[model samples]
Target: MTDFVDNVAFIGLGAMGYAMAKNIRKKMAPTGTLYVFDVFGRVCEKFRDEFKSFGPIVIVESPKEAAAMSQTIISIVPGAKEVRDVYLNNNSGVIVAPKNEDRLIMECSTIDSQSSREVGQALGTAGTGKYIDTPVSTRMQGGVPGADSGTLSFLIGHSKPSDTDPISHRLEKVATMMGNPKKFFYCGKLGAGLAAKISNNYLSCSILLAVAEAMAIGIRSGVDEKLLHEVIQNSTGQNFMADVVQPVPGVVPDAPSSNNYRLGFKTQMMIKDLGLGVDAGYATGIKPTMAEAAYRVYENAAVDPKCIDRDGSSVYLHITTTQEDHQE
Candidate 1:
């Protein structure tokens, strides 16, 4: 395994990717070279200019180009299909190798475990590029430019142990570049990372919806919404639903909920993840009632223009308002 401190490629210049790449540039020593690629040319250019002070910035034309130029490639695309298309898909609709065997490919997208396995298998067959799933667990606000200092938990699934593969060690470095390193578990296989992420998100969605429904009941019973939030905060509920993960607004000032659901994590994104969870459950013959419920809640919220602008936290408002109106 080669040191990832020097050459790095980051794909997908969306909110999360942009901030993560910037942090890598700021923290990496030995004057790291950053190769960035985004479908939008404007985004690539903007990042190039913004991080020019760090070191050499290569704005690549495509994922392959970026892969060709860097030793370690990190992808934070939208979903599994996009992840496959960028890393495995070739111009001729076939999968091709990006570089040599020592090269590391870290996929940071939140996707299904099965699809993650497929990508990992393809990379294995190529006998060159290594694949790892290192999905992030932080709201967009947490990844904002200067807010890189904020903490984030990582679920890393590497193909092999760090002692065996130098690539695994380099990935740990990349993980810390984004935020304070939480956990970089060497989950047994390639798809394990995706599995962990899917399960985590499913439970998160379920908790959010459950809290939302409970809070809505409080609102309908004449409890002030703000007061309800405060009461919940002071009670045992605060341990999990309120403190570790808040579902309602004004509870955590820095959370997406407090900001009226703007630019944290979109409801649509939550719906997508829930959908993935549902599919995973069905395939594994496991009950997914909570995931299904969360999906429906997000599906309805996505249709509302106001909710569309709000963060995933806005699900609380939907639950509260709907339940309150029912009683009226």
Candidate 2:
């Protein structure tokens, strides 16, 4: 394994990945190099112009190119299909890149476990490098705010316990560059992180819907929404959404709800993750009733003009504004 990390590659420069790469580039050693890549050439150009002075920023052409020049590679793409294309694509993927026994590849996307395991197996068979699933949890911490502050928490699924091996120890150190040091979890084997993330997202999405419905009920009963929020925080009904990322606007001054839901977790992304959770539940023979209910709400919000591109919490707007609810 590499004793020191001086060259790192970061793929996928979307909402979360952009902020994470920014922190990595800013905090990296002055002598180190940061390789960046995205499907959009302009995004890579913009990132380089904005942060080139901080450190060496090289915009690569593809995932393989990034992997060829770095000892450690990190990716946080959108979905399972993108995950496969980045790591397993025949012509331009990381699997065909130059082999380095010491290289470590981390996929931080929130995706299905089967797809993650398939990529992990291919990397092991090709002897490309070590692979880990490292989906992040940042909604309660203010989503993009958490990523920008380097305070996001990750659910890591690796071959060994964190810090138990040279590779895992290296993983722990690198993860801290983009996440809270105390919050990264070493959940079991290579695909455990994805499973944990899917289950957790299912619950959080459900919670957001629950909070929204509860708050709407309170407001309709002549109670001030702010007072309702205060009461919930002081009572057992309190949750991360109610207190930190309140579904009701004006309840939390800095929440996405207060800012019209732009630049936060998108409703479509929420729908995708919820569908993944529901699929996992059916695959495991357990019926996720609450997740099903929340999934329907998010799906509806994804199609609504007012909530389509807004934050996941904007389901509050969908619920309050809709005159009729679709029956399951």
Candidate 1 Cα outliers beyond 4 Å, as residue runs: 1-3, 92-98, 139-147, 159-161, 224-239, 244-247, 323-328
How many angstroms is residue 226 displaced in model 2 relative to the true structure, after the best TM-score fit?
Answer: 2.5
Lowest summed lDDT window (length 10), candidate 1: 138-147
Q: Each candidate's TM vs. the true structure? A: 0.88, 0.93
Against the true structure, candidate 1 reaches a TM-score of: 0.88
- Candidate 1 local lDDT, residue 98: 49
Clash pairs, candidate 1, are: 1-166, 101-128, 261-311
Per-model CA lDDT versus the true structure? 0.74, 0.87
lDDT of 2 by residue, 161-196 (tens): 444478888888888888887887788788899899
Which candidate has the highest TM-score of all?
2
